[model samples]
Target: MKQSEIKNLSLEDLRDKLAESQKQLTDMRMAHAITPLENPLQLRAARKVVARLLTAITEREQESLVENGK
Candidate 1:
């Protein structure tokens, strides 16, 4: 998923996507542990995507907090 696409998503949608993405990443790692994956690099890529999503979520939350003066 691209950063631009994620940025367009609402907070709730982003949270849902984050949960789904984490599950997928975990599953991929577990499967790879039992047997080498066809593309081992996928794990790294997935981690980066999760990081991007988290970053966006955090930024959104901060913006909301600032707007509300909390």
Candidate 2:
């Protein structure tokens, strides 16, 4: 997903997507271990997606903290 798309998602949706993406990444790794994937680039892409989702989550959390004067 694009950063713009990720930014559009609410925190709840982002969390859900993060969980789903992490599961998919794990499955992909297991499958690749059993047999070489047709395209290994998929793993890189999936990892980047997970990272972006995490970054977004952290940004929101920090924003909340700042707003609350924590």
Candidate 3:
């Protein structure tokens, strides 16, 4: 997913997506263990997407905290 699209997702949606992505990553790893994937780069791409989503979430939360002065 693109960073812009990910950032547009609501907090709940982002959390759900994160869970789903993690599950997919686990499945991919298991599959790879049995037999290497045709495109192992999928794992790397997925990881980067997760990281992007997380960064957006953290930044939003931090912005909220700063705005609230808490």
Candidate 4:
């Protein structure tokens, strides 16, 4: 997903997507260990997506904290 798309998601949706993406990454890793994937680049893409999701979540959390502090 693009950063723009990720940023548009609500917090609830972000958490749900994060869980789904992490599960998919784990499955992909296990499959890759047993057999070479047709496109190993998929793993890299998946990792990046997870990172983006985490970053977005963290940004939201920090924003909330700042708002509450104010």
Name the best candidate (by TM-score). 4
* Model 4, runs deviating above 4 Å: none
Scored against the true structure, residue 64 in model 3 reaches a CA lDDT of: 84
Q: Return the lDDT, model 1, position 46.
A: 97
Candidate 1 local accuracy as lDDT? 0.95
**lDDT tens digits by residue: candidate 4, 12-51:** 8999999999999999999999998999999999999999
lDDT tens string, model 2, 1-70?
9999999999999999999999999999999999989999999999999999999999998999999995
In candidate 4 the C-alpha lDDT for residue 65 amounts to 98
Where is model 1 more than 4 Å wrong at Cα?
Answer: none
TM-score-based ranking, best first?
4, 2, 1, 3
Superposed Cα RMSD, model 3: 1.3
Instruction: Write the residue-wise lDDT of candidate 3 on 1-70 in tens digits.
Output: 8987986898778888888888888999899999999999999998887888788778878888999996
Q: Model 3 segments beyond 4 Å from truth?
A: none
State, as a TM-score between 0 and 1, how close model 2 is to the true structure: 0.97
Candidate 1 worst ten-residue window by lDDT: 1-10
Evaluate model 3: give its lDDT.
Answer: 0.87
Question: What lDDT score is found at residue 60 in candidate 1?
Answer: 94
Backbone clash total, candidate 1: 0
